[model samples]
Target: MKRSYLLIALIILSACSDSADDSNREIDTVILNDLIQHSTEFEKKVYSFENGLHIAVGYGIANSIMVEGVDGNIIIDASDSVAEAEEVYSYFSTINSNPIKAIIYTHNHGDHTFGAAYYYNLEVEKPMVIAHESTSQYVERIMGILNPIISKRSTRMFGTDLPSEQVINVGIGPYLGVAQSPIGYIKPTLTFADELKINISGVEIELYHAPGETNDQLFVWLPNQKALMPGDNIYRTFPNLYTIRGTPHRDVKSWVKSLDQMRALKPEYLLPSHTKPLTGDAVMETLTIYRDAIQYVHDQTIRLMNEGYTADEISHLIELPTEVSNSPFVREFYGTIRWSVKSIFNGYLGWFDGNVSNLDPLPSEEYARRLVTLSGSEEKLFLALEEAVQEKDMQWALQLSDSLLALNYKIDSTNKLRQEAIQYIGGRSLNPNKRNYFLSSANELNRNYEAQPLLPQTSELLREISIDMFFEILSVRLNPKKAKGITQRVCFLFDSGETRTITMRNQIAEISSTNKNCDIQVKTSEQTLKESLAGVRNPVLSVASGEIDTGGQRTKFLSFLSNFTE
Candidate 1:
């Protein structure tokens, strides 16, 4: 009776302690928004230059340059949306009512190219859409492989998920999400290889393959006006050598070389896609410093990487010499030196940090459980985290929250604390993308908001790709584990009279254009097929709606369709 009473007393003490801890938990309301300086007010304004060269910067994420030739007009780098594009185009039309002779895409990035369709929609006699030969391929690749993932990250990176008060600017300008304009990516009509000097609307526009930002990046130079439009090659911020939102490897050497090439031109007027235009001495001076700064980081990163130094170590050691660091143009408002160092390091040496333990590690949940055990109990961990928050040690609080969240715990109090910690840290960040990511994550945890169901936007080029490419994309969607020991042959007969056969066996899918002995045959319109492949339409719904006809085995076809999801 005495031992049982002692145990009961211990349980009562523990319950009281738990209740006290919950009552004392407070959310950190310390506002740190004032830490970041907001510059560059976003507005729709046209900056006119000499020799009929006018650029509409600050209109959107991208700027449009209008080269008014003797007969017609030529525009480079269409603004992000239809409204922004039309606004700029209409402004130019008021100045010069000449038909748009040609539209040049500086790169395949959506912000640079999506507004092209607006030009066509305006009935400008279907102005020639010119771009690098690889632009279409890049667009197709993004739509097929990276769109869904990128779409989510972009919503976060641009702070579209956050409330207006919490979202500042996207480093360069205000977030462009407010503009309710749709994007219809127009296909390029004329594609060039390497370099092309073309006379459009009687303007001698020299297009050079100054590929740094994208493989398809091209800079426009007008010899007569002595104006240079470098697209995203020379943006305002310290170049996004590596974007926080995931991306394939960028050619750091090629980027440096591209800057050198631009410097060689020594143009009178330098207008980029993002920032204010520089002229006369400002152009050369800014370009020189930008090139040198980029070169310094690249060279230093490579040199340090040659040694046994890891990415994190190199980031701490290398600094952009005093002059480069102090440059107003190269300030890390968008991209920071630490991120660039890591990205450059990864470019040279892959993701391995030479830590043997990391090569094969336990799942995050298991590791987190071990950590909680080592730290004593979950309640103790929560108490320490609460104390950290009360002390305003956000970094420590964040670390503690990381442990709690590693087990995928979604309790209200813990998530609330984590949200506050992440938001505080994000407000202190100078890098725009980093701030967006941290704040976005915090917002996601705090709110159970649902994103509006919207159709996936695909470029006309994606729709025009070979049907075999579409099958190749579909083949990638098949879940390997789910398809084990499943062998199926399916044939598609489009209303356009094209027939394609697909055979799946042992986790491999083989696609062909010929008719084959198939267990199931699906007949659908070419438009429906395109829409379904682009993830804009549901295949199952199409079948139910009679847009798709399944012959032979409907159950087998539905089973095959079940393996793929949007």
Candidate 2:
């Protein structure tokens, strides 16, 4: 009789396993089908429009457009890398072999600006690089203070490290190609504050500073061609009001206003930095629905916030209306409604959710300890995690693993379980951003997983960055532990007639233009200093050769620099 009972229990367990597998398979089928259909939007080809304008789609994460002219052509938004840009230009050359007279950047995003060097170097005179007045400073910030964290998050968000089979698409494009070659960013020569109307290659182009997706975002209007190039503001996928890769709060109101500005022009051609271009009647229809979707989310979120709903609660409550949701342009391929709601909330009210309990919550580890006790014991908590996974309650299993991780109990086992849970959910996710982030997080849990290094910064790229920005970079990188109890002032005299000083006190590096009472003085050209700091040139050799002249003990100056090293 005991043998019969044991056999029955084993049979029941097997049946449950089969049921879960069937359910997962169904979810996977739907997700895979949707992603495959969406991938068609980025089919590699150059889309030629009326009036000598052609856009090369799927060459990289962003579209590179060429406007043919009488003597030369105008290039808008360079691809992602020199390699991708070269490939794109090869195709453009076939259509029109005219020299690239100018290159215009829609924003400061690497995908739009990094490939400009390829086009810039093609001409003897060099194409005039154009952008918003604030573009260069924004680019410096990304490459300077925020480089480390942004690079890591962007790598995961795009699934750049994932095997090809695991990645379907990056929503806006096929894949991110920034790592395929050296970053080829060139500083803009012509920058505008509000608007600039110029004739490039006999093409009457109008550029307006439209801040939406990025603070430096701009829209290009070709009055003669009846074409409007809305950089990243309007794409095929849902607008990333807040990207998972991390970004400053995207101003939703500004985004709506920008779209309305585009609609007012009533252009016949609509070309975006990412995805395919639209023409004729589709232009106004897409712009209207896209703007409506953004406004709806923003207004509804505000309404709920006023009703005392927390961000978490508001996220669950808000949903896109049927008309907006049905439109192909606003599908959650790049961004989702829930994440947007939370971001909108945080943007207005900051981190505090007006909840008393959340105002001063227990530390994570402490909370984990109490939760583990509530579960009877650490061992019981581990069992609960296992049971959650066994029951296919992946989200619960992931939460349980968090407690085990905080306690430092069975870390390897807990991570493995957490990895399995995330991978399962990721495999069935329709949104590529969420899917990639989840899978990338799972990959990170593996003991053998290696993170990719930051993109290589070439000497050419370093020349474009300003010396003042380098000092800002140094200030942020100052090691507080190493700087503790030390006070010193170091002054630098650059060949460009700029004097900057760094004063270290209270474990912080303060920067100023004052050059008086310097503890150590260094004299170097801006380029030489930039190269030395970037490791493109050897500092020891530079100092020994007098390229960098330290007015005092070399060892003392070198030691002071070491305090800023990570």
Candidate 3:
């Protein structure tokens, strides 16, 4: 049953690429030769194992698995948000009435962890939220300082603004048709560093740190059920060795080791975070292919890097080994080989591509102006770009368009041509991430500006941050120009009996737990303090409302608070 369904899924995978046309494909030099053979396959909606162990696939971009434990049910890898998580909860509720005892997060990705509160709210008493210890570090960084910028990038990556006809599935699943919501997450009560075994409702679950997609990534293993959940380690598509949305270079060496550990388990069932579950030979075969494909790319990239090949050169030279590349499971539906090759090169060798000219290259605008002067006219550049597009040479077209766009002269014709060219190239991209970037870039060109104020003023995750994190976040918002010669120390006295002294000097805010006599001392609740820092509450209003009490110089306190504004 598993084998038959998997075969059908592969077929569906190939059929989904029908939108990609020959001309579009030819123009995009980033695309590799079509190595994935088409098959008429459909993904299984759900998989049922013995003893009511069920895997719900395609709830969102990822999969959620339910285990019928002796006392209560346990869910692994919660779906994207409350809506999706509610659906998973409702589906399993029809099968079993047992209350959920625990929720295991594979990692801290919003898609996998945000739905936690949905399941948490389902039970009379909350279930335990479990994950690796480093989960909090990623959570704080992503939801804090990086939130605004990353959110905007995600808007592009998900094609949030594009119409239905223009945007397609996000590789692993259909478009996640929802806005960012933080209401569904319940903080983890339990965390582990390495291997940890625990019995939840008579189910023996073993978690092993498998750092691939994320540093905090871990896989769940069921000894009795013989089921293995590798999270995002082995999705159906070619593993996203590098996500263009911008991420620290993934540790390929450790990632390969994690896969080898999973291979040794030889579990009877394979349930990954994204895509369908597999059983028997299907499990072993899929794992082997995925492991080899990652290793092949990793090893070859390192070998070529040793030979002093630049990132661009390596990208052109490296191709997936024929056997590994030909595997139906290793297709570039979500993550492609070209992006991975560049990521690998960057990971091993720093950004410099071993060229001195690139070390101190002219600024993009200067370079563009120079290129136009050399070409003699903006019209000449446009003609060249049009010719490149006509010739189905994406590289030349984009290069020419970039130079044209960089010129101070905003040629309406040139801008339209570049936007059209990018849209054309993006439409034919097999990798969803690549497609999203291309289409989003084109959409931006049409609008004549990039998206701005990318982050929300405040978020639930921000609200849940600690006092230390609060000040740490505040310190980054400091404006050096505003405080050029000013220096002051402010003491915060919380209603909860906590005190922190913040020293501001040299345009930096240094937070310490110890209190001291300072230029200003303010007393308020942590929540009120955060609201003030977020600029949602005015300091003057807070003082008038008695939500805050000031000590020392009243004028000095107001002056200190004024320096810190949105």
**Candidate 3 lDDT over residue span 337-406, tens digit each:** 7788888888877788889999999999898888878988877888898898767687678888888878
- Global lDDT for candidate 1? 0.74
Candidate 3 pairs with clashing backbones: 8-41, 8-42, 11-39, 11-40, 11-41, 12-41, 117-184, 148-455
- Whole-model lDDT for model 3 versus the true structure? 0.75
Off by over 4 Å in 2: 1-23, 538-541
Cα shift from native, residue 351, model 3 (Å): 1.7
lDDT of 1 at 379: 78
Please, what is the TM-score per model?
A: 0.88, 0.95, 0.87
Residue 178 in model 1: shift from native, Å?
8.8
Better of 1 and 2 by lDDT: 2
What is the C-alpha local distance difference test score of each model?
0.74, 0.88, 0.75
Mind giving the per-residue lDDT tens digits that candidate 1 earns over 165-272?
Answer: 455567665554323466657878999898999898778889988778777888888888888888888877888887877777777789888888887887989988
Instruction: Between candidates 1 and 2, name the one with more favorable TM-score.
Output: 2
In Å, residue 420's CA in model 1 sits off its true spot by: 1.0
Candidate 2 C-alpha lDDT tens digits along 1-566:
00112232232222122335656555566556777678788888899976999999988889999999889999999998988899999999999999998999999999998988899888898889999999999999888778888989988888887665567778999878898888899999999999999998788999999989998999999998889999999999889999989998999999999999999999999989999999999999999999999999999999999999999999999888999899999999998889999999999999999999999999889999999878789999999999998887999999999989999999989988898888877766788898888888888987889987546788899988988888988998999999999999999999888999999999999999999999999898989988898788988888888888898557788889889986
